[model samples]
Target chain A: MSADLQLGASFRDPSGFVFRKNGVLLRQVNRPYLESLKRLTDSGLYGELTEAGLLIPHTEVGIENAFSDEAVAVLKPERISTISYPYEWCFSQLKDAALTTLRIQSIAMKHGMSLKDASAYNIQFHHGGPVFIDTLSFEPYDESSPWKPYRQFCQHFLAPLVLMSFVDIRLSRLAASYIDGIPLDLASSLSSSHTRFKPGIGMHLHLHARMQAKNADAGTKKETRGGFGKNALLGLIDSLQSTIEGLKWKPEGTEWADYYSDTNYSDAAMIAKHKLVAEYLGAVSPAPNIVWDLGANNGEFSAVSTSMGFQTVAWDIDPAAVEKNYLQRRADKLMLPLVQDLTNPSPSIGWALRERDSLIERGPANAMLVLALIHHLAIGNNVPLLEIASFLARAGEWLVIEFVPKDDSQVQRLLASREDVFPDYTQEQFEASFQGRFTVIKKDSVPGTVRTLYLMKRRAS
Target chain B: MKKLNRALNIALACGCLLTICQSANAYIDAGSGSYLLQILFAGLLGGLYFAKTAFGNLKAAVVRRASMHKSDDSASHVR
Candidate 1:
């Protein structure tokens, strides 16, 4: 596979397309967008936005580096360590992203510019916060024009947010199915009757959906006269901002959100486990640049990698846990916390299967921490130990895994209800299954607990 | 109350003009109904925003005046 490749998600906007040349990511600004680009820099909007950390900063490279003849300029943007989608973000992450977009729009308007689109995909978690990555999204403000991205904003940010707040948190996964945004109609239908009383929800979701259906066939191509004034546009942005602000999700009540408090490990064992993981991390040869902590409940152990200065991503299935982790690590620029269900992880989705990378496609991270998560997959989820080992082998190079025996209180709790059909879930079976794929480097029992932790290196294919 | 009434009137007028007046040159669809809703509510929303900002400025001015008075009294005492 070639190291230099054009990003699949970058082609939708005609202003420019992001591509890599000799492994360095660059965006080519087309001739049509040259004027907008000039206006952006000249008006000082770019400087203010980048300074505020609302927009991604980029440096203009020579036009000679253009991928195509139509390119007027090329930009070398500060690279994002990880590209996370809307679906992967927990409630607060998505809300924060939405708020960030609105803030940028307001600031752009002050500079006589406006955002061309309001796609959530344009927002990426960079430098510990959400940032607008699409430089081409800004255009010269038309005082008479309505906010063109209004519908898209509602669908992408507003609808999903309302649904998550009012309907169910799990409905956020609808973002994955509907690549553009969750359909407003679907969101409206799912919403409870009481949501209609809330002015913002009523207008944006229910009324907006009704209007869309009514005008589905209405010819919008014809030219006409009177315009949606600038004040109105500002008002619309403000209204959306307040509406989103009002929509809040408290990260509590979920099982894993309170995992550390409810754990069986003693204080000494907990401290020892943390120390052992750090020790194993230091022992890994050719220190890893990136570390992924799977099943990172509130990112307790992921902190070990972040403190060690490795770019770490904490993935947990619980939204509450991921939200808590995100809130706690807001200042850690090297850490990204996200929600992921290991059973059905994010897959390659969008226009083609290639538009968005699947969970595995993004990795084989330099190191992966599968701490206290084996039993859930093996016994609770009914996945075989061999399959679990095989998946983990493909996910990272150096594996730091904890094997929770059936006798462990947590594992026994899981088996308290279900029949224990898994006779092969022993520690001996686990080592046998993984030994084929990884070479064991270090093994130690966590001081006061029955749990065993191992550090292993991926065997060369 | 008068301002609110005027805003509502303007909104109603804009709603009436929705079918006749439309913007063009959008790359994305910018659905007809969505555009109409914005046009219809533009007057009321804009008025509300204007009123809110105006009230905020008024309150800030009052606070500034009171603070100035306090400083002037303190200076007089010093003299």
Candidate 2:
């Protein structure tokens, strides 16, 4: 393939970028980055890091044309795990990911190299913890350069962590709106009163921000400067490591972190629901099976697909819920469980919407489990039933979902505070609206609850 | 008749509960808010430990115990 492949968010990094050709994901390493690439591969550090689950492993593609100039190396990654932006990560996950990035940097520096940039997107969730994705992020240590990625590290990780720890966890949500990492000015404002005087947070965030502002006004940046020596660089990294250590946030709210206690399901019903989902997945047996469990509070149902040998994506809106899911996943060394708010899912916004894909653009899962979700989105969110049916239809071929009747206690509570305008939300009306998009395969009742589970397969148009 | 009554009561209670839970997820862990605060404090300490080099190496050692990150090289499947 030509070097001119169109990949929007991939254009910047001088090390090279990712592009897909004929369905295979490939990363092309540029000529200038050969030294760092050679050192990274030869150091034996890559294998050690990957096997420890601290790095994502890559395979060299077996194509004659894949390799360009002697300098360019084509690598085919086994799979793209979860594409969670920094904003989508729960407090613990973000904190853990930042640590992982810094650890990788420290190790790289030991090998006479360093990370050229500290973009959070370079870190991705894989087998529980965050792993380095950009194989090209490494560069030969230029002793004359003052650790160029320092400001970026602050923008992408440090400031956000400090603010979340000291001020409010919700402040971390600002990352979703600002793709260039969080604005330092905004972080300076959102930071807690105590953070203003905290040495590490103050120096890295407040003072560093002032320096950036002054530089902008002076019309001169690092362009004229030389890099820091060994002692200075180590000092910078050590101070950052200390500052990151000093900051913290504790997970709060029961359902966000511990969802099972208050969940309305009887133990028997929960097991039965999982059994039904398992049966439905075995029945459809779709190829390339990927399952997304929407509103998966703590990932109980999402694990069903993974246990059956399918990749599963567990999504929920609550950060606490995500934090809990990530904790469990880390304990078991599993690879699923992500944070999301379906109502306001991650969108593509950069130089163009085409820079990165929206959530829907990343999926066409083999199956989906919307267990006890429609009622929440329909009654709770006030989304129309017809639209809900249409959206779910595109998510998968075989969907095992639960329909909570208005008479069911959960639905009744949803109706209690508001007018019951959803007269058409009856089972008959639901079947009629969904029949156009799906074929009902089977339906079962939870042993103790009135919630009805429907196994529907998308009908070929 | 008794079974029907129990079911009815559960329905009524769950309905009210769901209605309330819809807005704010005010569910608490264990018992007192103070206990939850303690657990959170511990989690924060662990987060801090990770920032220090000691925690980083310890985590790697534990992960290497069973070669947890090992993946099959010869096997390739469609996703």
Candidate 3:
């Protein structure tokens, strides 16, 4: 077995590649990229972006243990806790990532450098905002050179954002299909003609797509002959910024978005639920370092977990709810709110299906919180209790879950539209099913509500 | 005759500029052309932004210098 394992997703760029050695991730900067790397560091742009938290910070390491003979230098970047795909991001998260990429590019220009790639995968949400993760994406800016990543930026950022805002918001799922981005042509066709009336859509999307179609017959050339000046590049970035800033997706009228406001829980009941969850978390041993709050509507409980010094990922099915949760995540919050339908989670995608990990591959978190969600998975989605327990068992070592009885108004509401064929959906059955997977540690009823919250540890395999 | 020659030269120059500006090889996609066109239109906006930032900086510098001079004057009087 080789000591170094190259990351599946980082094969495109010849300048550098990320690899793992003894489970420690490191980037080997190729010899060809040495000039660009020096320009990036010596130019002070790296320092500025890293200090501003716009770029991921890295430390240079000795190349004696390089992954390849052509290695110029090795870098160890602060690893992002969990890697998320663009398709999983809410409208606001994608927009923020796009704007962050363009902002970094503009700043790079000021320091006589430019971004070589505009792939959405290059940006990751860190702390409370998007941070550029690929350190080798920068190259020395030439006044005569056009921005090579312009087309990629439009495809990855502009097209998807336009489709989400103007067309159906669910069109963002197209990102999962087309890993590069939602194709410009598809985005242009999906959106109504009314979208052309918007500030940047007509020119950037419709016309741009047409141009791409016209030039489809042309062979790929690495460099186009043109003298694209610095001012022009800056102007392009400004236009993109304005276009993204102008686009907005309001989370209104969604059943989940209005969940907290329309819930049967009284103000006191809500507080009681929160308090019980906090207390249960405190009782857990070895303090969980990472937490996954499944069905975390607006991240109320996720925030509690974050406050307790845990890196929490708040997953919700509704884009609107996820967007709302993300909006509340300021600089102090450690929550990464993402849109994820528990029923159909994000799957392994890209070449060989291993380029991107499925939701489960990235998980088995230290602790998993499934609050007000069991009824939905069981009663709403028709998932068997035993299966749910098995799935949750694979998701975490400790599980803090709520079992909303059939009598609960929320569960009744779910049954209102469907036949009540859930014969084994009783509390006794729920506990029995979980017995095979989890050792129930404690169970308590939330005050003022007919809901039971249970804390359980995974049974030894 | 001279005016005619100058007109011909100007037309040839314009033709050359147009030819060079035509969307480059297959390497540069249509999206790049559309983006470049947008940049050409918004170049003035970028300039305006720089101008606004410059003016703000100038104002701050003037305010800082005036306050510093006033403090120096008070210090000398006290001495």
Candidate 4:
């Protein structure tokens, strides 16, 4: 019990390992990596990256609780509210991460250091865009050394982006199944013939896969290996930069991408709903720190929560809608948009089912925002009111939900296509089902509509 | 026995040429080879681009000088 619980995913790196103690996360730097660590900091690479907000800043802490004999230094990095994987990211998010990694590698090369690894998992969406989180990934650059992370970068960023853009956007989620990254051969195979004509795709993916296959089959090691000059390394980085920059994914219209434009709610009703939600948010004591906006289509309500200075996670099932939401999140904002269907969220994946967490593992946020979302979960999805209540109760300390009556055009539209089997889908049933788990403190019927917003606090045990 | 002796001699020569005949003491794989190939390609492509730019600049300079010489002759003749 005294041993610090080391993070499972961080064990791959021998230079340093992250551990948790007394609810605080700390990284223990090993003795063998001290020289490279010094080079990274002393060469001013650390300061430049941190100043530009491209790298996570850390403070060296006293090694009072050095977990192991190899611990040379302990660092406390800025805590990210939520750790989201690359698979959860949209096309642009993944693209930005790839470009950021390339930029880091270029800069590191200039400072006589290079990234030893280029896993997309090393990048995290912080403050609005991707930032490098792995401090131990850098090593002293050798002029003659080939970039060890080259193949990894291609698989992690280049292949996935190419597949997502040229083949299918949903193919980006393949990052979840292939943690190392989508294989190059698979990416090339999945892409269309047209993609082969694109310069970037042809060289980095198609030709790269062929080279990999050839190398694997030959099983030959060259006695006279070629050396890479600094210029050549920089040229490689530049090629990757242009290739990533040239790639683009236009947001295609989906079922919910333009939902707001065709909504039944009048302008006045929408305004009233926003106002009531704001008021309820103000009524909560001590002010909620984090809020999860479930089914936040294009993040209109999530924007409100963010404006109030709450770190908000905007979740939606529609890929296009989530993509649009992420595109609009400002660099200084507190919103993370993700594509997630509530019925089937991201499951525990990777080795031992602990490397990546399930959706519920990272949560129990300070508050939940369920505006215009309950109807879809209930009447549309056939989920019982009690089950929904129980799930919501486990998800947050406070719940702000909106009740859409069956007579409403939105609900009628949902029922229009399917059987109207949800007999207990009413306000009375909702309140009754939630009463055991939450205390309803405030309720208001939105003006100009039958929809009602309720502010409930999870009942104290 | 003669073939074996010849093979040993070749091995010794190769070892002598490659001085420091020990294991690499590092990790290098097919991916490393692929990366080296990329660097080679990038270097070639980049060098070609720089060469083209230099050639274009040289052509521009030569053309400008020729035009200047023609102007000078015309101006002198008019004087």
Model 3, range A342-455, lDDT digits (tens) per residue? 899999999888688899989879999999999999988899999999999989999999999999999999999889999999999999999999999999999998889999
Residue B47 error, candidate 1, Å: 0.6
Model 1 agreement with the true structure over A125-171: per-residue lDDT tens digits: 98789999999999999887778898999999999999999878888
Q: Report fnat for all candidates as fractions from 0 to 1.
A: 0.34, 0.00, 0.12, 0.15
| Candidate 1 displacement at residue B7 in angstroms | 14
TM-score of each: 0.93, 0.80, 0.87, 0.87
Residue-level lDDT of model 2, residues A1-461, one tens digit each, is 65435467777877777777766678887778777778888886677677777777888765453534543677776576556678778888888878888888878777777888788888887756688888888877876556667767888898788877787777777887777778665686677656655555655666555444433333233332342355556646665776787676666764447667766788888888778888877787544357788888888877777787777788888777777777776744444677777877778767778666777777767788888788888888988778888887766677888888888877887789999877778888878888999999988887788888888888896
Which structure is stronger by TM-score: 2 or 4? 4
All candidates: TM-score of chain A: 0.97, 0.92, 0.97, 0.96
Native contacts present in candidate 1, fraction:
0.34
> DockQ order of candidates, best first?
1, 3, 4, 2
Provide the interface RMSD of candidate 4 in angstroms, 1 decimal place. 12.8
Query: Which ten-residue region of model 4 chain A has the weakest summed lDDT?
Result: A216-225
What is residue A124's positional error in candidate 3, in angstroms? 0.7
- List candidate 4 stretches off by more than 4 Å: A1-3, A217-225, B1-33, B39-42, B45-79
Clashing pairs in 2: A144-A226, A144-A227, A145-A227, A146-A227, A256-A320, A256-A321, A409-B15
**Chain B TM-score of all predictions, in order?**
0.60, 0.25, 0.50, 0.51
